[model samples]
Target: MKSTVLTRRGALKCSLAWAGAAVWTHRAPRALGFTNANARPRVAAIGTGSRWCQRATGIDGPHGSAPSFVPFGDYVAVCDVDADRLGLAVDVVQEWTGKAPDAYGDYRRVIDRNDVDVVQISTPDHWHAKIAIEAMLAGKDVYCEKPMTLTIDEGRLMCEVCRKTGRVVQIGTQQRSDESFLTALAIIRDGRIGTIKKATCAIGGGPTSPVIPQVAAPKNLDWNQWLGPAPDAGYRYLAGDNGETQSWSRCHYEFRWWYEYSGGKLTDWGAHHVDIATWAMEKGATGPTLIEPLAVKHPVPFSAGFPTDDTQYNTATEFLIKATFADGMELEIRHDGDNGILFEGTEGRLFVNRGKVAGAAVDDLANRPLPDGALRAVYKGKEPTDHFRNFFDAVVDRSEPISDVHSHHRALTTCHLAGIAARLGRTIRWSPTAEKIVDDPQAQSFVSRAPRNGFETEV
Candidate 1:
C-alpha cells in the first residue's frame, strides 16, 4: 500500500504477508487428501449462467472451440443469478461429472465452503473484482474471466488481495496460452522486431440493437442479484408476446455494449488483443503514463464520464485511443484495421491474432524456429497448452499462473483509461507510479466508482 513502484515480486510479497490472517480464517479443518498433485481440486463455477457449457461444449456444437474445464478439475458446484441459466449449467455439470454439483444463487455461499479449492469467476465486469477478492480471502484460487476489473481502483485492490492470499490466479486472457500469440511474443521478446517503435490493436466495434421497452423480468431470474453492484434500473425486455427472454441488447453477452455494466469493445476485445500487445512490449505490470483520445465516438452522447442516456446502450462504438508509455512506446487501439495486434519495430513488423501469426518474423520462425522452453518461459515456465490446465497446475504447485493479476491489472488499466478518455472526449494524463489521473480533478474522480450500497466492494 506504499507509494512506490510496483513490481511483480514486490506485489506478491506484500500480498502474501497481508493475507496471512485470511489464510488462518480459511484453515478450518476439512477432509484431507485433496492436495496431491494427481488429485483434482474441487472447483466451483460462479456466474455460470452466461459462461455455461460454452467453454466445455462449443457454442456452435458439442465440440465448440472455447476452453473447457471438465478435464482439469472437479466441477463440484455451479452458481448464477438466473434460475433458468443456473439449471442449464447444473445439467451440464451433471453430464460432465456424472454426478450432481451443488447449485446456489449467491456467490458468497459458494466461496464459504471449505471443500471448494478453486472458483471460476465468469461474471460480468462489475462483479469480477468482488468475487475474486472474496474467493481469495476464503482461501480459494481463482480463474477469473478477462478485463479483470471494471475500474482502476478495483484492479489495484484485486492485486492487493491476490498478493495477500498468495492464491494462484489466472486471468482469462487466454491469448497468452495460444501458440500463435506465444510465438509472436517470443519473436518480439527475442528482439526479432528490433527496438519496438509502436504497436496497434484493432479490436472491432460493438453491436447495436433496436430500442426495447421496460418489461417485467423473467420470474426464473433474480434480476436484482443479476444487476449486482450496478445502479438500480428497470429490466429492459425486447418487445415480444411472451416474457421468456430478456432483451438481447442488455442481457447476457450484450451487457458488454452498455457502459453501465462494461466498457464495450474497449474492454471486451481490448482485454484480449490490447493485453497481448502490452505483454509483447514487456509493459504488463506498468500502465500508460498518458492516454490521448485521437477520435472518439460513442453510441450515445456523454457528459463528464457518465452516460447521459440510461435507456439506450452508451459505450464507445468506434474509437482510436492512443496511449503513451513512460518509455515513449505508443500503442494505438482502434476499431479499424484487422482484428489483431500489429507490432512495428525498427527491424521488422509482425501481426498476430487467433487466426494467424504472420509477417517477416513469423515467416523466419519456419526456418529458425525458437529454442525449446521459449513458450514455457513466456508462460512462467509452465505448459502453454491450455489456460484451464495451467490454473489447476498452479493451484497444485502454488506458482503464479501464465496470466497473473499484476500484469492483467496494468493492461486492464490501459483499457479503462481509454474508456475514460473516450467518455470525456479528451486527453488524460496518468501517473503510473501513483496510479491516478494527473492534474485534472474531474478525470481523477472517474478512477473509481461508488458502488451501490449493498454491492459496495470492501477489501
Candidate 2:
C-alpha cells in the first residue's frame, strides 16, 4: 500500500472521493501496512510539555521494553513554542529511538512533513483546535488533548475537518480509556440505577485570587511563542524571581490557570469529570438545552493561588451551574461534591468516582442474577481491545476510534457552556442544533474570543 502525502488540497480530493464510501460502509481506510509486518506507522509528538511528556513516558524506551511502544511507531519529530521544553523532548526521543527526530518551533513545519503519519498534540487549550484542524487538513491523524477546543465553533469545525479529510482523531479525554468510567457507564446504561433523574458533577476550585507579581521569563524559554494564538500578556515565572530553574515546569503546566492561556479548572479538570459524567448520561454526543449559573459566593480576599480572590484566575472557583437537557433531565455542575457523579434515579441512587462506585441499590442489583441477554446490552462496550492501541488500530482499519471528534465536541460543548456561564455570571439559553445562543447578545459574545492577529483560527 502506498502512503499518500497529506495536504490541504489532497484532503479535499480524498474527501470527495471517499464521502460515499465512508457513508455507505463504516469501514476505515486499510492499514498503511496490513500486508507488510516490517512497516510501522511513522509518528511525531507536538507540544512536548508536561502532559505530553507524561504520555510519552509510557511508550517504550530505546531498548523496546514496553509491549505497546515496542518500536511499533517511530517518534520522527517534536515541536514546541518553548525552546527549552522542545529541546528536552527531542533529547528524550533521541535517547529512546537512538536517532534524533527533527525539531521545530512552529507546528506547521512538523505538519508539513509528509514522512509523519500521526501527531500527538498536547498544547494549551487555545491551541488545541487550531493545530488539530491544521494537522487533519494536512492529512496526519491527531491525538489532541481534551476540552478539545477553545470554543464551540472550533469543536464543530474540527469534526467537520476530520470527516472531510478522512483523518482519525482521538481527543485526549483519557477517562474514556479508563476501566472505572467504562464500568460506571455500563452500569448506568444497563438501567441498574432505574432511571437517571439527575446527576451532580463536581470539580475542585480554580486558581485563588490576588494576582501574583510579574516576573521575567527565563532566558532559555521563548515566552512569545508559548503564548501562540493568544494575545500578548505579561509573562510570569512559576517559581519566585531568581528561583530554582525547573525544565518542564517553565511555561507549560502553570499556563492552565490564566484565562488567556486556558479555561482554568473548568477545562482542565472539568474536561475529565464533565466528559465522563455526560458520557455516562448518554449525552456525550449531544448537549444541554438550558444552562444557568447558580448563586456562587467567593471567599474573603487573598493573593494568587487556588481559592484566592485574585482576578488572574478568571475561572469560577466556587459555583454551581444547572444544565437541563431536552429530555427534561438535569445535571448539576458544582465546585463541591464527593468528587464523582451521583446518579439519583427512581430505583436507587448510585455514586461513582474514579476510585469507587457504590449505592444501596448497587448491592441489590449485584445480588440479582442478570437476565439472559441483558448483560450484553448494559456493557457500553469496550474500545478495540486497548485504549491507545485502538488509536493505532483505527489508523490502520480506517474505522472511527472510540473517542471520535463528534462525541468529544458534545462533551466539550458542555464544558465550554459551563465556563461561559461562570464568566458571564448568568443563566443562558442554548440552541444545540444550531450551535448558538438565543436572544441574549451579551451571552453569545463569550462563545469565542478574538485571537491575536497572526494566530487567529481559520474556519
Candidate 3:
C-alpha cells in the first residue's frame, strides 16, 4: 500500500483557553514525511462503532462537540466488526473528509496499512490492549479509548509495549485536555490546596439490565468476531419494562455491563475521575496499597470471581471501594454523589467534574492566580488544546502525550482492583512496586486472563 501522507490542514486548533499559549510546538514537522507545514497524519480507524459517531459527530456539551476526527488525523481507512456500522462509518468519514477511505471488517487490515500513521482504537474495552499492542508492533502509534483494558494485566502489557516501541501513544481520557481539569490541577500544584489527604471520586453507578434473553445474531453482525477473546455466548436483549420505549443488548453499548467484555462503571468512569485524582496527588506510577470493597451490589450472582450466570449483566450496579495509598492518602470510589472528584487537603478542598471546578481552591485562584505557564506545566509543558488536537500535535512533536499509558495504567489498576474486590466480595492487598496482588493467588489470577488461541494479546 502506498504511504498516504494525507493533508491535515488546521490540526493546530487554538483553544480560547490558551489561544496563543507558547505557540504549541516542540519540533517542526519532518520535511520528508509531510508535504508541507500543514500536512496531516493519515489515520486508520478501527472499531468504527458508537464512539466513532459520538466523537466524529461532535455532540453538544460543556465543550462544543462540533470539531471531530479530522482534528486528530485524516482517515485513510476504517474498520469495524459489524458490516452495517462499517458501511455507515465509511459514509460518515467520506462526508467528513470529502473523500472516501478504504473499508474493512478486520482491524488487522487497517493496522497493516503502511500509509497509516495512527491507529485509533475505539473498540469495546476488551479489545483495546490487543489491538493497541498489535498496532504498536506494526509501527503505528495508538489513540485508544478510556478504560483501556478489560483486565489489569493488559495495562501492564500496554506500558511495556509503549516503552519497547517508543511510540507516542495517547489514551482517550480527554478530561486531561479540558481547561476545567487543567485549572483544577494547576491550583493544587500551586499549593492552594495543602497536602492532600483524601480524594473521593463520585463516578456514579451503572444501570442494571433485566435478564437479556438470547436472540439470533443479525446477519450483518459477526457475533463470533465480536466475542473474540471473550467466552462464546448467545446474543441477548430485552425491552424496557414497558417493552417498547428502550432496549438493552449483550453486544455493542451494553458490552460494558458484562465482565467478559469489560469492567462496569468502576473502570468506565473510574478511568476519568481516578486518573485526575491520581495526577493531582502525584501518585506517579504507584497504586493503592489496599483496595477494599466497602460495599457492593451486583445485578447477578458472582462466584469465585466469575459471574455465575451468563445471561444477565454481572457488573456491580452500586458499590463503594476504599483505596489506601502509600502516602497514607485515601481514595474513595463510590456510586453515589455527583459525578466528579473531590479533593480534600489538610488546609483546603475542591470539587471538579466535566461541567465545572468548584470549592475554595477555585476562589483562591482569583486572589492568587497560578504561576504563568502553570496550566501548561500541568499538561507536561504543552499547551493543552482539545484532546484530539493535542494528540495530533504529539504525533508531530513526539513528546509524551498528556494521557500517556503509564499514568493511566497506575490509575486504572485501582479501578481494576476495586472491581476484583467487588466480584469476590472481599478486600485485596496489593504491592504497587511489585505490581502483584500480594496474598491470594486466586485474586492474583484475576489480573490476567488467557485469551483464546490465536487471540492472545502477547507482544
Locate the minimum summed-lDDT window of 10 residues in model 2: 241-250
TM-score-based ranking? 1, 3, 2
| Candidate 2 per-residue C-alpha lDDT over 1-459 given as tens digits, one digit per residue, 9 for 90 to 100 | 012223333543555335434422332232565335445667777777656664333323342112233245677788877677677777778877689889998777887676677788888788888888767765677888777888888887888877776888877766776666666666677777788889888777764534455578767667776777777877654344321223212245656656666776778877888777777788876789899878553433322312333334445568788999999888887887678778888777888777887877456656874455443333233332445676777777667777788987887788788777776667788998888988888777778777776665443
RMSD of 3: 7.7
Question: In candidate 1, how many clashes are counted?
Answer: 4
Worst 10 residues of 3 by lDDT: 1-10
* TM-score per model over all chains: 0.90, 0.84, 0.89
Error of 1 at 378 (Å): 1.9
Error of 1 at 118 (Å): 0.5
- RMSD to true structure for each model, in Å: 5.7, 5.8, 7.7
Model 3 CA deviation exceeding 4 Å by range: 1-38, 55-67, 240-246
Question: Order of all candidates by lDDT, from best down to worst?
Answer: 3, 1, 2
Segments in model 2 whose C-alpha atoms lie over 4 Å from true places = 1-38, 54-71, 238-250, 297-311, 369-384
Q: Give the distance in Å from residue 459's predicted Cα in candidate 2 to where it truly belongs.
A: 4.9
